[model samples]
Target chain A: MSIDTSTAARVAKLARIKVEDDALPGLAEDFNRILGFIEELNEVDVEGVEPMVSVEPMRLKRRVDGVTDGNQQDKILSNAPDAREGFFAVPKVVE
Target chain B: MSDLTKLTIAEARDALRKGETTSAALTEACLAAIEGAGALNAFVHHTPEIARAQAQAADARIKAGDAPALCGIPLGIKDLFCTKGVPSQAASRILEGFKPEYESTVSSQLFERGAVMLGKLNMDEFAMGSSNETSVYGNAVNPWKRGNDEAELTPGGSSGGSAAAVAADLCLGATGTDTGGSIRQPAAFTGITGIKPTYGRCSRWGIVAFASSLDQAGPMTKDVRDAAIMLEAMCGHDPKDSTSADLPVPDFEAMLTGDIRGKTIGIPREYRMEGMPEEIETLWAEGRKMLEDAGAKIVDISLPHTKYALPTYYVIAPAEASSNLARYDGVRYGHRATLAQGDGITEMYEKTRAEGFGNEVKRRVMIGTYVLSAGFYDAYYNRARKVRTLIKRDFEEVFAQGVDAILTPATPSSAFPLGMEMDDPVQMYLNDVFTVTVNLAGLPGIAVPTGTDKHGLPMGLQLIGRPWEEGDLLNTAYALEQAAGFVSKPAKWW
Candidate 1:
């Protein structure tokens, strides 16, 4: 699956990064190289193997399900660019 | 003041315990040091009043005989960790004005133990780069010199600031997180000792997640003993992080005997790749020789699947990061750009993210999205997962073959020029080749400064141990560190 300029543009848009028109070719080339390298995985034989979650064969530690927050909302929201009514304020969308 | 900046955490703690020094004095000394060494750009944010208040609290605790092990000890917290009131941007534009309602678990634990906070230190944007140059705040200069030249050099990242701050004596010790040698590489470049503990040993609760599974918070200090003491204080089970282990934390400080009489250490044949610099190889050999002289059996072993680590890490880390970072959509946290001409809600999100994230972060998210896309998921992400198993199995096989630990170079080479590889992503990614396998296998690894390269920049010898065997790893590192005797001091005495 070679990445062309159009695919590269789509990927750039999806990733939310702006690439100038002149830079698109280079970006596409880089993307193609990465995809080409990834294609090498097709050669490996993993017919019956299970995906490893962790290197150590131990189960994840279970914790009691709880909903206790750090409770410093006012302090945390102090750094927000736009906050109103105890929540982050964004441009009205539903209206 | 006896250059309080030069004192280790242990020394500082002792002074406070003996009533020979006050926390206020220590904190003031550190602040002065930071001011004097302002050129290093080690700190992204400093709250002197907050530090003074905390120091006073620590002093009160000591007077009441309720002092913890690290009481009154000043330390640097990496900017990547969220502080309740301080800006925690992870050195990226996206999180420019983001603060958290919670404190990172490790830093909070340190604060509870009476450690005084110096401030949030700088790091690569989203902890992405090998050099600190990627930071939005600016690059942290390496404290060590290249001969008589004083021009700025890189303090390795993404924990570059933590390492540089400690090396330059701005703090006694500092907290650093290692995703793929972030702590160790910086510690090596700055000529300090940093350890990345076994996976799940440290809680990941409030750490700005880079690569979730690979990230482990640890201590970077001037020496092994301080690393041990700080590591003990930082390691504990936190219920907030699902991946955190519930195992009983060990007494790391108490376990440091500094004796490795009859231990077995392995030198993996696979780590000596073709492009390894001659100086690094020489230093590695010198390290092995020192360990052998100390009565440790050195054997040659093979991790056959070593080369596959980088590619596997590239696939898996991005996949996880893509998922984790999705929460930053214009709706909740971080810098959200307002809609421009002809832009709607969805376009706002796209524009905001585009404007917020740096080039490197955007590249990673793009790569991550590509690998996990509908048509590529099984081919890329799943295959990478299987290869990850092989990498772990390689470590398991060697450890099972009576090898207590493996030795390798922490990085392929010493720190490169600050902006040398900024234009080439592949070259930058290769800097982590030697470190990523350990993270992939979830093993404990420590980077101990061995000696300098021909250019006078410091290099490190990495010691990797089996899972949950940090005790053995540190003990071996202690022995080798004693024999290596690499004493590094910053050029400027700030």
Candidate 2:
């Protein structure tokens, strides 16, 4: 129920947020505090209760699986930090 | 001409239709006010050119006799909304300079109805914090001071800037999305009216996702009627958001009859927390009496899981946030970290996020990531969802018993001075205690300014209504507004 420095580091990595070595303890403490607060949920008797996926009682609406809109690769890449040749350019993933 | 910015949406609409005022004049007045109120930091982006053009278009629409309800009204948009070409940062550094290519569905709907946008307002970064202090633009100073004291008070958060803007008359109203009391808490803090409609009442198409299930968009306005008017224009079923209900958006403005005679109002016993401010308690009692005076049958009720709403919110919101924010990886839009010689994509995401997110955001993302992790998923995320169901059932039970609305103190206390609880996140989280249950249950809730604390700061009373019953909720609040007759505006310090 409590997160230690190593756990915090693991979580930060999983979240893709960089928490340096020195900051992990502090991050752990923050995590512990939040988790401690959230531990109150364990008191509830949730036997046979369905985890709510939607607030309203409605089945997810379905639409015909077709391309409703597209054909604007330029617009899609407009805000990219690096877009080249009509594609999003990232640091070389395949070396 | 003197104070067109101060006019409520209804008044502005009436004046415009009577040919007594033009949208251009209203826009100019609001723009001038916004320019002058720089001290409040309510408006982070000033769009006078866009406002003028929209106002001009609105004038043409009005002249053509095709004006909608929001025609010619100027309003401030929360930074969370992806306003096309406007800097919609959600008050975060990560999104610095990111002008969204597409408009958020709610905002586009408003614009389509001829609502003019003054600019983007400040908020907690990604709508994460209870105090506006977490905003990258610095805290939006509360226009209301502590009874003529010089120290600045917080306008409450996530929707703090929206509240402050409406309170200071910088804009007639502003859009606010409440994940956990972001709208109602700030609205209470700033003595304005805010309503978070039922979860699916408004589409979430272009809103920067916070807690997907919990985040519902609503209007923060000067009064109950204005809140009603703006909420109507802001809501519709959008096919783009599958969660959006196909149910019709009722004429919320027309439903404000202010006659709640024979309406059953519940006073939830669970909301009366220990250590609650005497002022808030008295305010709640006064609210009960006022509703009673309006012929509402007041009954005591119990929502047993009320105490757990905040805990559930913290878990679910951040868990969803961690996932939603994953899209901000370096490859796409938003701030990308400057890399060192040997760095790769992982390094880029880490550094970008580490530098980009504020401390509160980082903490939340960490918590969210932790809860959804392998070992803890069932213990945390799944458990919170079940508690959420219980919390929701509490409301359903009350409503099934013919309880039309539930009234409680909007906040634990009036707006506190800025920086009072910055060190303690738990203390700050308590601000949403009264408001979060509505979000957990996906019910319509509104905060109506009802009274003032001893320090003369405004205090509000909240009314929780049935699901998709914003019109009824607004009407109940309208009755409270009539009874309380709270007309005190914060003395303009900024």
Candidate 3:
């Protein structure tokens, strides 16, 4: 499962990180080294092993569907890189 | 009064109770130490005013005859844990200029118990690298060095700064987070004790996310007792973090009987890897012999899945990291990129992330995205999760066989000089080979500095415990510490 440069470029886009054409080879090399080692899992016999998703035997804690707390918009927006009218501002999405 | 900075957290607490010392004086000593150890680059942010205010408050609390165990103790908080109004970047450029309005639950609990914060410590950026070289604040030099070799060595990371600060006596103890041996490796390299409790032992709320399931906060301290004391305060069930355990916090410090009588310590044969440094193997053998002398029975064990731990961890951690890091787009609290005319929101995200994340972080994200992609999900991510189950089962089966704990070398070798392994990222990943299995199993693990190598650089042995049994784990580590009698410290170089 060697990850080629084109595939590495695609993954960079999927992860929303920009990679220059020159850097793709380096990224591909990393992916190859990691994936090459990880491919050893093929030799592992995991026929009936249930995936241990969480270490604890926990069902996600649920809460009653209600607005228990709100109105801390100022505190929430304080760290925003760009905030306007108590909402996070972003580049124009619509033309 | 300068000697007060050398006392362990437990000793310092007792001294404060006896009126032999005051929190303000200790804080001042630590501040002076930090100011002098400038070459170490251990501290990334210095909050002298906050530290002084906290120390004063701690003294008043003690005078009022109501001081907690940690009252008046000055400690460094790793950059991964958010302290209210303190600059914490997790040693990454992506989070430049970001300060949380709220505090992480672990640090907040430590504060409520009277611990004084000196500053935020440096670490591998986003907890991604093995060495401290990836830090945005530059590399943190290990206080310990090969004798007569002046080359700057790394305090093994991503808790490198925390380990270095505690080893250098810049603070009493420091808060550290371990995703993949971050706490233990650095602690070993710096000749201190560090513990990474069961995964759910500490709350994750307000801490910057790395690998959600594997990340845990712990204490890196001068000795086993301080690690125990600080851990007791650092861990509590928090409703704020859904994955936080709902178990009652125990008195870890009190449970340290320093007796391993009638205990069964397992030495896994798989850990005796081929071509391992002879010193690490020798130290491990010594650790087993010491436990045997302490009236404990030693048994041979096999964790067959040990060979696959690194691969399994690489897949699962990055997959989770990709999902967790998606929130770091330009609109969020972290750094945002400048926009060009006609640039859409997508450009903002791509450019911001491109300019913000370091090469190591970007590589991890890319690997994560590729594994979780639609075409390779089963082949990589899902398969890794299943393999993870097998790894956990290996530990469970061993523990179920009346094996009280498993012992192994903490790191492959002692601290190496900076720039030694930076060119090969795979070589760096191998540093966690002995430590990552514990995280994959969600078990508690401790790294206790046993002795120094022939080069006079310290090495440690890890003790892995069954899930949620940190008390027993700490007791075993205490017994080993007592038997090893590791009293060597790095000479002052800064």
> How large is the C-alpha RMSD of every model relative to the true structure?
2.0, 1.0, 1.0
Minimal lDDT window, size 10, model 1 chain B: B485-494
How would the docking of model 2 be graded? high
How well is each residue in B404-451 modelled by candidate 1, as lDDT tens digits? 888899988877667788887777878888899999999999999989
Can you tell me the DockQ of model 3?
0.81
Clashing pairs for model 2 are none
The 10-residue segment with the lowest total lDDT in model 3 chain B: B325-334
Clashes of 3: 0
* Clashing pairs in model 3, backbone N/Cα/C closer than 3 A: none
Off by over 4 Å in 1: A16-22, A37-43, A61-80, A86-88, A92-95
lDDT of each: 0.85, 0.91, 0.93
Better of 1 and 2 by lDDT: 2
DockQ of 1: 0.50
**DockQ, prediction 2:** 0.83
Over B1-494, each residue of candidate 3 has an lDDT whose tens digit, in order, gives 44888999999999999999999999999999999999999999999999999999999999999999999999999999999988889898888888898899999999999999999999998898888888889999999989989999999999999999999999999999999999999999999999999999999998899999999999999999999999999998898899998899899989899888999999999999989999998999999999999999999999999999999999999899888888889686889999899989999999999998888888888888888999899888988999999988899899999999999999999999999999888889999999999999889999999999999999999999988899999999999999999999889989
Q: Summarize candidate 2's per-residue lDDT along B16-129 as a digit string, tens digits.
A: 998899999999999999999999999998899999999999999999999998999999999999999989888888888788889999999999999999999999999988
Residue B317, candidate 2: Cα error in Å is: 1.0
Docking quality band of candidate 3, CAPRI definitions: high
| C-alpha lDDT of candidate 3 relative to the true structure | 0.93
Compared with the true structure, the alpha-carbon lDDT of candidate 1 equals 0.85
- Pairs that clash in candidate 1: none
Q: Give the candidate number with the greatest DockQ.
A: 2
